[model samples]
Target: MRENSCSEPRLRKSRLGSFSKVATTKPNSNATSENRVICIYTYDWTDVADVMRIRDELRKLGITSRIPYKSDEDTMIGKYRVRGDTRISKYYE
Candidate 1:
């Protein structure tokens, strides 16, 4: 008799689906104002990197920007946490 070895465990697939559908609210409209603030939602570290890249690009364009610290109450969306908030001049598109 030969002994068999398994390197990885098998994962069972769900009949319904791998993930449940999560209801998401539509994003708020971008309103123009003197000191406009845009909320950037980051699901993971990748999003944070994206925000940093955008910031660099904006800096090259000589655009003023800032990322303010957000409290738990202010940044919570359902179960996801908002990575950062981008504040910019009203003239920024």
Candidate 2:
């Protein structure tokens, strides 16, 4: 996956479905959807390259994968395991 630097701001959509430019930076430790902008987007399952790229990027940041669980049950399981030492939230899923 390509790293988006500050020069390349990403367009993120909020929970309300409004879009805005969010500067790409190392994620803040205290950021939350209720307090900051959270990006929510969807991709086609057939787009293997894009999906894999995103998964790899998250892995590099020490975030665990949510792939091996029973998501089909919709029990609101923990998606990823973000370490406490990292700036990102451990409960970020």
Candidate 3:
């Protein structure tokens, strides 16, 4: 058994969902929509091949995310984007 373990740290996948009306019920509010959360695991790596491999692994999982993890290494810049029925609260004073 090889002892030199090269295990990548597991990323925590968080799923954002619409605000629950039951939990945050407003007397006269009409906002019941939210965005979905995605797992963004981008970081500096020692080699290029490793990053590509990791990216392929994530793709096989049938996960919906943004960008090509392999090519983006040249530009170490990553950000999260959300576009789904975005809305603001309309509370009555």
lDDT of each: 0.33, 0.34, 0.32
Clashes of 2: 0
**Candidates sorted by TM-score, descending order?**
2, 1, 3
Q: lDDT for model 2, on a 0 to 1 scale?
A: 0.34
Which pairs of residues have clashing backbones in candidate 3? 16-37
**TM-score for candidate 2:** 0.28
lDDT of 2 by residue, 1-93 (tens): 232232123223111122223434557543443333323222433445544554454455464745321121222443322323232232223
TM-score (all chains, Cα) for each model: 0.28, 0.28, 0.27
Best by TM-score: 2
lDDT of 1: 0.33
What tens-digit string does per-residue lDDT give for candidate 3 at 19-91? 1112223332322344322323334344455455555554555545643332233324432122232221111
Model 3 is weakest, by summed lDDT over 10 consecutive residues, at 12-21
TM-score of 1: 0.28
Task: Give the least accurate 10-residue stretch of model 1, judged by summed lDDT.
Answer: 2-11
Instruction: Give the distance in Å from residue 81's predicted Cα in candidate 2 to where it truly belongs.
Output: 19
